[model samples]
Structures are given as structure tokens and as C-alpha cells.
Target chain A: MSALLQLTGVTAFYGAIQALKGVDLVVNKGEIVTLIGSNGAGKSTLMMTICGNPRARNGQIVYDGEDITRLPTFEIMRRGLAQSPEGRRIFPRMSVHENLLMGAYGRPPAEASQDMEQVFTLFPRLKERMAQRGGTLSGGEQQMLAIGRALMSRPRLLLLDEPSLGLAPLVVKLIFGAIRELNRTTGLTVLLVEQNAFQALRLAHRGYVLVNGAITMAGPGAELLARPEIRAAYLEGAH
Target chain B: MVRDAGLSALVALGLFSSMIGVRMTQGDDGMTLTGRGGALAAVVAAVFVGRLIMLAWRARRPAGTPSPKRVDAGLSRIGRYVAPVFLIAAIALPLYGGRYFLDTGILVLTYIMLGWGLSIVVGLAGLLDLGYVAFYAVGAYSYALLSTTYHLGFWTTLPIAGVLAAIWGIILGFPVLRLRGDYLAIVTLAFGEIIRVVLLNWTSLTGGPNGITDIPRPTLFGLKFNASGDADTFATYFGLDYSVTQRFVFLYYVILGLALLTNWVSLRLRRLPLGRAWEALREDEIACRALGINVTITKLTAFAIGAMFGGFAGAFFATRQAFISPESFNFAESAMVLAIVVLGGMGSQLGVALAALVMIGGSELFRDFAEYRMLIFGIGLVVMMVVRPRGLVSGRTPSIFLGKRKDIAADLVAQGRG
Candidate 1:
């Protein structure tokens, strides 16, 4: 598979501190790529910069061969890129259906509705609670709604930041299972950011280990799974 | 005639008649029209009358329906919304009331237009504006100068006023695009005060403190409303009395039409992509920027469009008054208009209009309590805010289409509240 999304030498900063330092990553078309790291490892930071949140102070992001380093988040989203932000920044005041629709703000109406059907099929729990407010939903359901909302944009690349971060085993299983099913059926390219390295690597084709602000280890999911150090730090304690 | 229809009708009629003399001092032109204060009084009065009748009728036989209590409850619920309805009716009062009254109507319409105008910026976009009156002055002065110098008619000056306001809006929008919440509010307040001060001090072009008077009034076709209607003097030849009231009423409707047009346009723009962009900006500006919505363009459009309406209202004020003064466009006007929308309910079209009506209308109602009139409004505003933090019609929504909502009342109380 050719590269669908590429981030090279990406650097970012908050008011004074540097967060990302020359991070390089790639997710090929139709592949599930994961970024596994401990807390504050710049995984989420990299995800945001790719989507133009903190903005890349340096380096480049290319989506479908077009440089998108400085493009605003909405524009990147318009070009078939969507993110289910960490902590599920779903619009809390809105209803479940409205939150889902918020994701499709860039999609054409007919296409968005079609994608809505697919999201519903992927996580049927959301369908049952569509009328409930985003704030009222349980944690697992919120994550599912977040993922579903992102997909409403009919994104060419779906970026999920910690889908299993705070979810129960069943919910984690359900979300990961849905992610795999999406890749299998739609050939969607994914860039997942997770602290739950075990589940992430298990589901991903490959992943990059972010230590501090740099990439330390990169290999196939199985290879990363075998690393004693990686196992002890994250996966061993996590479900 | 609503449920318990028979009893409520008598009460409404009683209200409708007694309220006629409520204005007391009939202006040489006629009665004063709506303002936020005036609108509130009308609401209270209407409810008092309607409730009294409702109680009597209910005691006699209650609305002859299965859920009679619900119907009565619904009447009270609706009765509470007297401000919005009274304000809407006030928009048309200038037509029949006479010249002085029509002029007051013009004032009401000016605010109605301003409230709606700012609603787009502050309400929908969730931006707090203190400088909104600056745009009003811009449009007013633009209309005044353009009219007096160019000898342009009211219709002719309107577009110029709108364009000028929009241009200023763009200029104002850019500086504050980076700001949000209280910071945005302070910046906007400063912007409005700057405009007012500039107009006050800029003696050369603005005509400064004296302000431009004798701004031409609108004409029907080419015919002026002046009595010299000798063909050259259109008013005399028409066989109708050359009453200034006619001119005032006509102008009142013109503003009404324009105000209605403003409502229609905003409603349409809201449904389009731009409107959605504004909402996104409101919810989360950072996220909106990420979605590729140019923060600058969205912010600028809101300012420009909102200012354009302010300009329209300002221009109308100039023509209707036949005089323009700097005092007319002040920070107080801005505050009053903003208070109307916020009190009405942000992003609520009907709510904003009601706010303007109550605010403007209630002030007029206190014509009897002239000494304490302002205090009444100030206190009323405070009390209203405390009682209803969201607004008078808090959390009201727009239908995707323009039709009343369907009702299969969920509870008897809900039906009554309806």
C-alpha cells in the first residue's frame, strides 16, 4: 500500500515548551497504523499537528500526496480527513444524533446520511441512544459516538486518538472490533493514538513508539508486542 | 380565539381598548410606539387582562374540553409570551397612529432592526458586542450626509448606508477576530464608543455635534409627500390630505418591510453553509479553524452583515426624524439593543423582537411614571435577568421550515403551558 498520510520531522510547541521534535510517521492507504506511547509522549500532539490543531512549527504533513502542513483543521477535514479527538470532545450540549451530524458538517447531505447508516451499523448502541444528549451517555458510548461522528465526514483517513482509553473491556472490544471491521470493509486508512499499547498493536498492522517527543521504536505490531520493555511499561498492566 | 376561547376573547378585547389611552400624551403625530420597556408593560397588561377573563370563564364553566385545565394552563404559558407578541404588533402601530406616533414606531422599528441585526453577531455567533451602535451611527451619518449632499431619496441612501456599515464592519471584525468571550466584548464596546466619539468630534464631514438635518424623506415613485403637490407637489394632487402622519406611517411600514426583510435574509443565511460556520465558530473557534472555515472571513461576514442592518436602522432614523444628531447614536443605544437580544434570548428571532418591544414599549408605558421611568427599566432589566438567566423565551428554537410546531401534548400541564 502506498502512503495515504505522511508526517515527517513534525515539530510543535505550546506557549514556551516544545512538544513534538522531528517525529516521522506514515500510514499507508487501507492500513491501520497506531502510535503507542506513555502519557505526555507527544502522540496526541502529533495527531493534532497532523490535523492542524497546535499547527506544525516545522516539518510537513502530506495527505494523498498534497502538502497539508499549514492547512487549517476544517480544510484538512474537507479533504477527507477526520479526527475523533482525545477525551471525546463531542459537543456536549448537543444530542447524540446532533453530535454525529456535527462530524458530517463538511460532508454533502446525502453522502453524510449514507455514512450515518454505516456508523449506526458499526456501533448499534449509538443508534439506540441517538436522541440522548452527548453529556448524558456513558464513557464507552461517548467514545463510540466520537468515532461515529468522525466517520460522518466520510473521511478518506480516519484518525482516532485513544478509542479504548477509558472504556471497559466490553466497550474496548466493541470499539476495536468496529475499527477492524471498518478497515476490512471500507479499506479505510487509520492513524490511531493510544496509551493502551497492547490492544492498539494487536489491531494495528504497524505502530511507532513515541518516547518523549521522538520516535524510539518502529516495527510490525507483532514485533512491538514481543518487546519486553514495551510490554512491561504499558501492555502488561493494561487490559 | 384560543381555548376557553370565549372568556379569553372578552379579556383580550378589554385589554385592547383600555391600552389605547395608555400612552396618555398623544404626540402631535400620535401615541408613542414600542421600546423594550413599553413592550414589557403590554405583555404584563395583556396577561393580566387575559388571565382575569380566563379565571372568570374557567370558574363559570372551564374550557369545554376533556383537558380544560390543560387549555387554561396553555393560555397562561402563551400569556407569558406577551412581550414578543406585543412587540410584533408595535412594529405596525406607526401606520394608523398619526405622525408623532409613527415616528415612535420608527424608533421601535429602528431598534427592532438593530436587535435583529446584532442577533446575528451576538446571539447566533455568541459574541458579546458593545460597539454595535457604532455601526448604527455609521449607517445613519452615511444616510444623512449622502441624502443632504447628493439630494438622494431615502431608498437611494439606504444601500449606501448598508454598504458603508458593512465596510466598517469588515474593518472592525479583523482586529477582534483573535479575541473571544470577555476580551471580544471589551473590544467591541471600545469600537462602538470610538465610532460615536469620532462622529461627535469629526466636525468636517459628519457635521459633528450639529449633525445633518433636512435629510430627504422617501418618496413614492417620484412623488413627494409635501403639500406643494402641484404635479411638482404630488401630495395636493392626490386628493388625500397632506398629513405628515401619512409620511410617518408610510416610512414606518417601509422600515417594517425592511425589518421583515432583514429577518427573512438572516433566516435564509442561517440555513446556508456560512450560518453553520458561524455556529461552529460559536461552539469552538479553534475547532472551526481546523475545519477549514476561515476564521477571518466568518468573523468579518458576521460583523459586516450585522453592521449593515444597524446602518439600515440608522438611515431610517435619520429620514424619519428629518434630523440626525450624534446623541442619537450612543453607547446607551448599543446597550439597550444588546440587552434586548440577550434578554429576548440569544439566537432566537422572535425572542429578540420581543426583547426590543418590551424594552422600548415598557419605557413608553412608564410615560406616566416619567420621573422613575428609567429606574423602572433599569430595575426591570435586573429583575428579568435574575428570573430568567437564559432569556424571556429561553432555549427557543427555529423550525427547519416556517410552520408552527405540532402538538400532542405530553402532559396535561404541558398542554396547558402550550
Candidate 2:
């Protein structure tokens, strides 16, 4: 598969305290890639840098043969890359539908209703609760809404940060299942970051192990799942 | 001694009236008579009768209980809408006064219009614009320069001045799009000062603080407010005396028209997609930017529109004053306008107008208080903010329809606390 995105020597910071340090990674076209790490392991930071939030102060981020490293968050978003940020940073005051519309905010503005319908098709539960304020949603429902909102942007690659975080086990399973189904049916590429490595790796085509702001290991999903270190750090303690 | 003197004076007036067998014939012509001491007598008599009726009515009602005003939510909303009109409609009263009081009323009206202009900036956008007077300055100066040097008519210069202010608004919007809150306010305040300094220093164009004088008054279809008044034309052309009240009525209606148009345009804009976006952007710029709502465009639109209104008011003010000066659009003027908005409620339309009246009218009315006037004004504002920090009209609700209320994210799952 062709590499759709390439990040090399990417370093990011927030005022003197470093979050990401010289990380190199690649995401292939039509792939579900998961970066499994603990909290504060630079997973979310890496995602933010890639999406041009804190901004990639150093390094090159090439997406679809264009350098988007220096672009503002909104411009980067317009270039077919979107993120469902950590904590499900959905617009709390807006309705679920409005939240989704916000995702496609810069999009042709005319295509919003059509894009929202697609989002609803992908996550029907969101359709049922479209009128509800985003904050009113349960943790699991909020995660779903956040993912659904990102999909409204019709991105080439959807960056999912902790989709399963803080969710119940069944909800985690359902979210992973949805991820798998979305990848297979829609052919939508995903760069997912998660603490639920076992489930994330199971859904992903490939996986990278992010340890202290750098990827320590990279391989196929099954290989990561089988590794002794991956087991010790993630799967061994879980059911 | 004062009480005794007042009773004796009143008794003298009564005897004087009785000696002449004074009578009032209620008609259109009697309207003129009412102005010359006749209305005062009638009003005093009416008040006495009204007080007696009120006392008798209270006596018939249940004793020992204070009567409530019976204000409901709907009634309160209606009161809010109508109260300003009822309170301020007495601008019509000044027709009975000399030209000086009518001029005073005109000044009050101009301030009300200015307050409405600033409301769009600080009220709707939530951008604390301290340089609003700068836009007013721009408009006035633009009109003065264009009208005198270019020899343009007042009507032609008015729209041109508004356009020029809006252009300045856009120019101002470009630099400070990234800044917010206190920093933005300080920058805007400096901008006002900068404009004033420029006008002062740039001696050629502005005439350097000496100001432009002898500016022509607005003419109505080639009929000047000179000896040939509206009534004179109507009398000769139609063989009927339109009365001098026609002039007063026309000027009153002209301002009324401007105020109404401003209200209409503002209200319409509020309902548009742009206004809602402005509110959303105000609430959270980060989210708005993230949503792909161009922050620069939103901020520029707000400044431009608000400045346009300021220009409108400024043009009106120039014509009203028939003189232009940098001193008129000083930092104090900006503060007073901002104070009006804050005291009114940032987002309220009517609140801004009422606040304007209170600030301007209070100052004029308290001219008797002299040095203590501003002291009283300052204390009243502080006390008002303490009583209602949001504003006088802050209690007003935003919309008719309600949105879904957020439920707290609490688990029904029991935890062992006991």
C-alpha cells in the first residue's frame, strides 16, 4: 500500500516541557493504525501535532504529497485530515447534530446536511440523539458522537484519540467493532491512539508502541498482540 | 417661611385667575395657550383630583395590606419593550421650550443613537471595543473634510463618511484579530488616542483641533430652516398655516425615523446567520476557529457594521452641531459610550438606548448638581453593576424557543459512602 502520510523527526512542546521528541512514523493508505500508549506518553500530543494544533515546531508532516506541518489547525483540517481529540472535546453547548456540523464547518457549507446524513448512517445512535446537547451524552455516547462528528468532515484519514478510553467494556468492544466495520466497508483510513491495546490492535491492521514520546516498536497488529513486551505492558493484566 | 411664601403665592395666583374669570377652551388653538402657564395650572389641578381619587380608591380596598403591582413575566417583557418609549416620548414637550431646550433634546437623541451604534460592537460581538469614538471621529472628520473642501452637500457626505468609517473598521480588524479580552481593549483604546493625535498633529486636513465651523445645516428638498420654514411653504402653496409645530414635528419624526431604521437593521442582522455566528464566536473563539469559521472575517464584519452605525450617528451629530472638532470624540466620549453599553447590558438593544439616555440625560439634568454630577453618576454605575453586573436589561431572555438542558454525568451505580 502507498504511504499516505509520513512524519519524520517531529518534535513538539508546550512552553519548555516537551511532549513529543523526534518521532518518525508513517501511515499507509487504507490502513487502521493504532498507537498504544499510557496517559502522558505523548500519544495525544503526537496526534495534535499531526493535526497542526500545538503545531509541529520541528519536523516534516507530509500528507498526500503536501507539507501541512506549518498550516493552522483549521487549514490542516480542510486538507482531508480531521481529529476526534482526546476527552471527546465536542462543543458542549451545541447539539449532537450541531457538533457534527461543526466538524464540517469549513466544508462547502452546502454539503453539511449530506455529510451529517452519512455520519448518521455510520453511527445510527447519533441520529436518535441528534437533538441532545453534546455534554448531556453519556461517556460512551460522547465518544461515539465525537467519532461521528469527525466523520462528518469526510476526511481521507480520521485521527481517533482514545476512542475507547473511560468507556465500559461492552462499549469498548462495540467501538472497536465499529472501527473494524468502518475500515472494511467505507475504506476510511484511521490513525487511532488508545490505552486499550488489546482491542485496538485487534481492530487495527498495524500498530506502533508509543513509549515516552517515541515509538519503541512497530509491526503488524497480530505481531504486536503476540509480543511478550506488549503482553506484559497491556494484555497480561486484562481479561 | 418658604412654606408660607408658597401658600401666599399660590393664593395670589388663584385670586388673579378668579378675578379674570380664566377659562380654558380645549381646541387645537388652545394648544398654544396651554404652553404659556395654562398647562401648569391644568396639570396641578389634575394632580390634586388624581391624588384624592387614589386616596379614596385605596380607602375602599382592603386595609393594612400593601397592594402588589401584579407584574408577571409576560407583563415584565412588555413593560421592558414599552417603558423606554413612554419615558422618552416627552421629547415632544421641548417644543414648548425655547430653541435651547430643543437643542438639548437633539443632543440627547444623538447620544442615544451613538449608544445604539456601540451596542453592536461591545454588545453583540463581545469584543470590548474602547475605540468606538474613533469611528465616530472618522465619520465626522470625513464628512467635514469632504463637505467643505470637496464642496459636497451634507446628505451626500453622510453616506460617504459612513463608508470611510467602515473602511477604517476593516483596517483596524486586520491587526488585532489574534488578540482578545483586555489586550484587545487596550489596543483599541490606543487606537482612539492615535486617531485623536493624528487629527491634532495633521494640521492641513483637519485644521488641527481648531475644528471646522460654519458647516451648513441640512436642507429639506432645497427648503432651508431659514426664514422660509416648512410652515411658510405650506401656508403659501396650500393656503393653510401648517403651524410652527410642523417644524418640531418634522425634526422629531426625522430622528424617530433614523432610530427606527437603526433598530430594524440591527434586529434583522441579529436574526441572520452572521449574527448568530458572531455570538458563537464571542462565546468561544477557539471552537469557532476550529469549526472553520474564519475568525478574521467574523471580527471584521462586526467592526465594520458597528463602525457603520457609528458613522451614521456621527454624520447626524455633525449636522446637528454644524461644527466638527477632535475634542468632541475624545477618550471620555468613548468611555461614556462603553459605560452606556455595560450599564445597559452588552447584548441588549433597548438596554443600550436606555443606558445612553440615563448617562446623557442624567448629566444634563444634574447640571444643577454641578461638581457632584459625575460623582453621583459614578456611584450610581458602581451600585448598579453591584446590583446587576450583567446589566439593567440583563434579565431579558435571548430567544423564544428553549434548547435542550444538559444532564449531569452521574452514574446511577451506587457507591458505598455510608
Best by DockQ: 1
The candidates' DockQ values read 0.22, 0.10
lDDT of residue B275 for candidate 1: 76
**Which window of 10 residues has the lowest lDDT sum in candidate 1 chain B?**
B400-409
Error of 2 at B245 (Å): 6.5
DockQ (0 to 1) for model 2: 0.10
Q: What C-alpha root-mean-square deviation, in Å, does candidate 1 show against the real structure?
A: 11.5
Q: Candidate 2, residue B63: CA error in Å?
A: 35
For model 2, how does the per-residue alpha-carbon lDDT over B1-418 read when each residue is reduced to its tens digit?
3344445556655755554335445776553222335744654455455455546665675765332234234445775667666446644555476555665566666667777777777777779899999999898888777777787877788789889999999888888888899999999999999999998888887888898887766656644454453553543455555455444544555565566667777778765556655765765665555455666788899999888878877777776677988889889999988998888877777777778778887788899889999889987897776445667676433321224322211111122111
Query: Where does model 2 sit among the CAPRI classes?
Result: incorrect
Candidate 1 C-alpha lDDT tens digits along A1-239: 79998889999999789999899898999999999999999888898888888889999999999999988666777898888888877655556766666677755778876888899778767766666667779999899988898888788898898888777888798889999999999999999999888889999999899998999999999999999988888887676
Clashes of each: 37, 1
Model 1 per-residue lDDT at B152: 81
Candidate 1 wrong stretches, greater than 4 Å: A94-101, A125-138, B1-101, B232-234, B396-418
Where does model 1 sit among the CAPRI classes?
A: incorrect
